[model samples]
Target: MMVMVLMIASYSVGSIKVEAAEELDLQAESAIIVDAKTGKVLYEKQSDLKLPPASMTKMMTEYLVLEAISEGKIDWDTTTQVGDYAYGISADPVFSGIGLIQDKDYTVRELYEGMAIISDNATTITLAELVAGSESEFVKMMNDKAEEMGLPEYKFVNSTGLSNEDLGENYPEGTEPNADNLLSARSAALLAYHLINDYPEVLDYSSTMMSELDDQPLQNLNWMLPWEDNNFVPFHFEGVDGLKTGWTQEAGYCFTGTAKQGDRRLITVVMKTDSKEERFNQTKKLMEYGFSQFETTELFEAGYQIQDESTLSVEKGKEEQVELETSEAMEAMVKTGEEDLYELTYEINENNLNENGALTAPVEAGQVVGEAVLQYKGDNDYGYIGGIGTEQRVDLVTTTGVEKSNWFMLTMGAIGNFFSNIFTTVSDAVKGLFS
Candidate 1:
């Protein structure tokens, strides 16, 4: 949608090629890393391959629950009675679940903690049922929310992410009994991007390495977390924090991980790795590559005036032109030393201009005239998530107002223009006659 005009160099230099993350040899079937703040993609590998998300599908459930709570539709303290279906799943050891007693009321807070901490299937189903009255209805919400969030590839058949067949006779009504929730690595990463951004408190639950559910010890499945006493301390990475992990025969070992060091937070997704540890290992590689290779760099400061194109001609105004500037700073995740590869380009809002491409008189200061967009001149700019807002841009606004010329000044200008046109016509005739 950006109708770009001319580009201006943001930095004076660049030539040293920054290494791209494509060089990373991950063992996963699909993988991706993205900047949490901007949703900018740092790396991707077979990212569009649709694969089972397994318990990572619970992230959608987690998002909805938090969103519901935030909307006051449901409170954490609100209680929902566990039905026969959820209780049965809880008692089954084949699936990951903490036991739930049928017909017993459990607070949303308790069920959410159980689902998030341990990937409890029954708790997930219970929360789904609580939110939408049935797991089937919750699946509709899941698919609808996915579309709304702009996930490129995802399908939800049940709230728990278990193959509906795995749910046996209890599979939600009006769903394919054998269908399992599926998501591409890019979709998973984008979902996590929205999740942590929209509901940061999910981290409060995800970051807890250990908690108890009904006296039953619950352990976080994400081993890459920086818990000091972590049994998987060998996999721990500094700054690594809360995220979800998953595994099933179909999903293999999948993990959606996020970590923050300073103001930069990175989200990673690795799917269908050989082992539980391999998923974390692949994620660690992505984390290292992102942290080491990228930094949040300011490409252009707010109010940066583009040289040569900084002013707009104002027709019938006191001033011939009015100054323009960027309304906000343009910052993006750039390779540490590759800041110069980006240039600032601007697009004029033609609708705001006259046929002569000049602003009408009485232009207001700070009115949006166009957009200032960032253009990368380097290799492997993976772009942002969803591909909709790929262009990083800010509003191009007027730096100062331009008042309309007084009637006398306007009349004088018109008279001068009329004579100038006649003189030009006479001069052209004389030149032709001389020739």
Candidate 2:
């Protein structure tokens, strides 16, 4: 698995990660600590191994539901009848899980809290069915979204993190709990990355230690919250906030947790620990180590002049050469104790240039002429493989004889522009089909 530092102007996904530094041992079978602002992995222990994520799988479910609401496909007041499958799981009353009544309808808002806070299996299935019409179909959507998010390793057999038992008689006879909700610690962190960053409001639900369902108390499963009693949890972290926790006889104790210390937010995923407190303890250790041990370093200044000799050769313009410079700065987060810093190198992408490999004479100021790609190598100089390195247009200009192209060349340029626009439109429409 790879981790990388990203410059945050805002949050978005769809990029690959590269490996960075290594850290101390963790008790969990698979664990990862990620810098939320930059998606940098501060620590890891078998993070790429596939393991049963249990209820932590619900993170993806929560994200999808929230995203649907954000996109206006669903509303807070939208309601769905509690079906047989959802009602059966709710009625089980095992592990203090919420019981939903058949022949009754529940709003999306209610189910969101139920699934997020208490990790209610029935409410999870309820929202799943409401979103996709059936559990099987909902599971498909989960996998699809996983692939879309670059986590092809995740496979969802059910919405809730049920394992170590049959899904009961409510569904088909062959359904078993925790069938294939396998995920890597890295994948889980990515899910949390999108969860907290894309839907910052989710913390509102996950951070709650308790809530009410039909006037009955609903307890949050996360043991790390800074709340009274902590249900006898060994420690109470000051900034620890919202996230999901899961466990089963087969999956053991697992938690996908997050916390904010100062301006930095960190995400930790610990899977298959010996007990609940252990998972929380290890996660706490990871976060504490991250905040105490690392700090951000500016690798490059924004709009830094990488090249200003004004010697870039022009192929067909009136001018013989044009000036070039970088358009954006790059930042990197590194360990605090370390003295050496990440190295930055710049290069121009040939493919980013226009026809004739020259500035169309009289180019406007600030016009993009080529691509400037920046790369990084850590203090060890081993290279940051998945570093989310920076890329920007190399803006440049020319002042005279801009309209030098003959009628034939100009006609072809116009025709090429027309075809490019058509292709882009078609591509965007196709992408919208899946979104």
Best by lDDT: 1
Estimate the lDDT of model 2: 0.70
Itemize residue pairs with steric clashes in candidate 2: 3-18, 17-386, 18-386, 90-99, 302-329, 361-402
Clashing residue pairs, candidate 1? none
Per-model C-alpha lDDT, please? 0.88, 0.70
Query: TM-score of model 1 relative to the true fold?
Result: 0.93
> Alpha-carbon error at 188 in model 1, in Å?
0.5
Candidate 1 lDDT at 5 equals: 67
Per-residue lDDT of model 1, residues 1-435, tens digit only:
335566686674455565666678889999999999988888899999999999999999999999999999999899988888888899988875687777778899989989999899989988999899888899999999999999999999998778888888888788877888899999999999999999989999998888887789898887887667746898998887779998888899999999999999999999999998799889999999999888888778889987887888999999999988999999988887778778988899898989898899999999998998888887777888877666788899999998999999999999999999999999999999989
- Who wins the TM-score comparison? 1
Model 2 / residue 422 / CA error / Å: 42
- Clashing residue pairs in all predictions, respectively, total 0, 6
